[model samples]
Target: MSKKSYRNKIEIAKEKEKNKEELLKKIERLQKRINDLEKSLNKPQNIQDKTELYLKHPEEPVVTPTLKKTVVNEQILWEINNSQRATKGLFEIKGNYEKICSIIPNALIIADEKGKIIFWNKAAEKIFGYTSEEALNNDLLNILVPSEYHQFFKEGFNRFKDTGEGPIIEKPSEFIAKKKNGNNFPIEITLSAIEVDEKWYSVAIIRDISEHKRIEESLIQTHQKLEGMLNNAVNTLVKIIELRDSYTSGHQKRVSELAVAIARKMGLNEKKVKLIKIAALVHDIGKVGIPSEILNKPTKLTDLEFNLIQTHPQAGYNILKEVDFPWPVEEIILQHHERIDGSGYPRKLKDDEIMVEARIIAVADVVEAMSSHRPYRPGLGIKKALEEISQNRGILYDPKVVDICLQLFREKKFKF
Candidate 1:
């Protein structure tokens, strides 16, 4: 009874193993049949049936035509692998070009070699009131160039077409271009030629530079107005300095008169003459900051007091340097006390460093100060004044500027 039962259990186990092997072989045959059906459906006529099957299911998986295109060549497969990067780069360039056109507030056009428009950004629509579709087929010259420039446009275009060269060599040329509303406006146009498929095309970047030109002109006018105001302010400041020190009243004016005469004799230009005149008027402006007691001291200045008096020129530079006067008032004040051989106070600039304007003013300052009475000393007459400069030509005065002063006093008979 036990042997029979063991034999029955063994037969059942063997039957189960045989049934499992039969099921595995059936699954393998089914996979092969599916693969063969896919190949058969890829044929031209069977494709319609496969599409109908997909349509019936709607969500059934199927390969796309794009997948076939991606495998067209090894180069294409590599390009497909990098397609996301390529697409992102293209979108960035498009966005940049759009942003540029948006900011410019003018029409921009890119044309092929056949004069067919290819690119028309947003500002082109805003300015010319034309859509990208309308702009694409239009001839650029016909759209923007006025009737008068037709012959000129033809000549230039033909020249570029024939020789791939022309006279429009600069970055841009300022010209008038007509708008869609038939109004004329100024434009600055820059053009560069590009080639694709062995054909020449142009990528011209156009901007309305009229506003920039207007701004530049306004700045020039403002600068001129500011210069005039500074001159008036300086003159007023000097008058106030003179009013308090009545004895030195008319001192600067007389020096300026003599300085002008000497400068004319020296054959200086109008600009130099003007600089000399302004320098003469403000040569003693530093004395304004000096204490009135020291300036009008009846007794002789002590060594420390005299050292304090010598700081006037540096004070004058500090004051005038920030005033925005067209004349170099800072240099004039700095160099007025500077001797020709570097032997004067506060930056003793010698030779060419001492501007000719300061040299002329220096001579005039001494002549005026010596010929007129000061708190420090009584007046030395014109004869003694002439001798002082003559004794120290080149050593103290610039010889050429000094000679002019001597000639003005002696030969020209110019007097205060």
Candidate 2:
């Protein structure tokens, strides 16, 4: 009860605590020494002996009782910290997934094996006119497909689920879909599948193609109309030349047919073949101005009259040059009389200098003119006409065109 007695009691309690701490330290030192002795003994033991020890004491911990192994609290703390960091990472990943679903314009949706909608995004609402909450757990086909194609779509989708083969998933398909208002329209659709927790889900990308199809049809119709108008114009131009000279009226006609034939046999293109026909029709159009006596004379003309006849080509060029034709009209009219070897013509042009169309007309003109009778002279016949060109192939005509013409006459027995 006295103050001195209380002080003595406090000192005795402190000394007892100090002695207890010393005893614990001595025990730890002895345990470490015992652990070192046991490890040295276990090193030389065979695996069979170690297995027997494990079997005999199955409940015992792997560490020895002698080893003073304190729990590594710092390592446990490190592992706990790592687990918390991993959990935080998983939460961030979940947030990113939600963000992506919101931003992607394409319908990032999932449907179960039965074609029931599971997850839908904002794009699905915009495109299909169904909100995410309304679409979930609803049968996708019944919601979007027209009544006529619903059964067909069911068969196709079920087939894909069973066999992993179907036309819809492998390639995009065109299908008619009905809107919420019951209006139907064409859509291009692509489908893909993904497995989530052992169940397959399908996602589709759809685009409306009604406008594209309309534009394509319009282009086709316009092209056909333009082609018809062009043909009518060409026919009218051919008729005009036929009305001019009775002697050469049908002269241009027969020559046009034969010229186009020869051009095709020579492998000329459609454009060049058309040019040859138009050029042949207008070859002697200049004769419209010449006196009828000069053009349709029943007898041979004087030297002066023949010289005036040569002027028809220059006159034809002047007439055709003023009016626009798609072809090089003036060049066609000018070069028709110009020979390949510079031998026969108003202006003596030669060889490749002459256009291919003009070269064809030259052969056609010579052949038809000589084959058919003229008012001034008797017919030379097709034989002599072919003979004339064959004999003077390189001399007065292009040799390649000349050869094809001869082969047609001789071997093929080609008729006018």
Candidate 3:
């Protein structure tokens, strides 16, 4: 407002304008010197003369003795501002990178070391039903992770932030995640660690596995249906054969139960155990071809009638060989009567010549038949039955099968 102050303001503005002009002039002079130096180098005589007056241009800037070369000042200006240009380019690249993240099918989320979400892509929005705007700056724990697992994950996340270590980093694991609408579903998540400004950040790729789970469950149900049908067919066949002699069918059911327990106690896998069970269930299926009067004969039979009973194994094999089974059910039934030594009837299969399923069924069949009461004889006690297998462990039965059978009865308390 004072006259002297106003005049001083005008002088300051003039000084700045003059400085700007001088800077521009210096740039122009530098460019001209470069042009003249280039022209001098192009001359044919200038190369041959090797003159001390290398620069023909009189307007060339003076080189101070402290510096042997006169450097390009404009080049220095470009170098000084190079980072400014680079910052602009980097900004553009950041946008393109974000576009790529958005287009990926899996949800991409970047959360800071403190577990605060900094980035959420389009797929993240779709999967969690939360827009990027809503998810950004939110706590990753509260937004997506189930509340019940909050403490479990909070501890892990804190550990990750401090030491850049956790069980989940770089590992793909399945977990349950909650959506915005308060429904929970399965998700497969993979996490990666990145360091920025001496701080750890998590880059997570999340995928919805709801559809996969549905498909898996559907497959399991279909398998169960097929299994039920197979079981029903086996039961119907067993019932048909049992119609001739009730004692034989009841004996078969108890044998199958004991066989399954023995197989499992031996740590045989499910498929083999399953085959053993089915084979034991139908071990007497050949009796359907035998005359009912012979099967139901209450008194001790003659040697010829006993030979007729032994024919049931081969006959049962013949009966079932035409039917398709997942395993060697027919062969197993045929070999059930064969002993481990070269003594038993039919093919007289010796040790290792018989299938292991048959060997297991042989032990189980002996135990259950001896333990149950017969129509003509009192049931031998379980003590006597165990002693029978113990006496015949290596000679007539598989050693492993006999040991497991003994353990099942004595320790595991398995029963028919």
Which number leads on lDDT? Answer: 3
Highest TM-score: which candidate? Answer: 3
289 Cα displacement, candidate 1 (Å): 6.7
Give one digit per residue, the lDDT tens place, for model 3 in 356-394: 899999999999879889765889988899999999999
Clashing pairs in 3: none
* Per-prediction TM-score to the true structure, in the order listed: 0.49, 0.51, 0.70
- lDDT value for candidate 2? 0.68
Global CA lDDT of candidate 3, please? Answer: 0.76
Worst 10 residues of 3 by lDDT: 73-82
Error of 2 at 68 (Å): 63
lDDT of 1 by residue, 69-143 (tens): 111111211222233543454454445545544554445566766677877878677666668988887998898
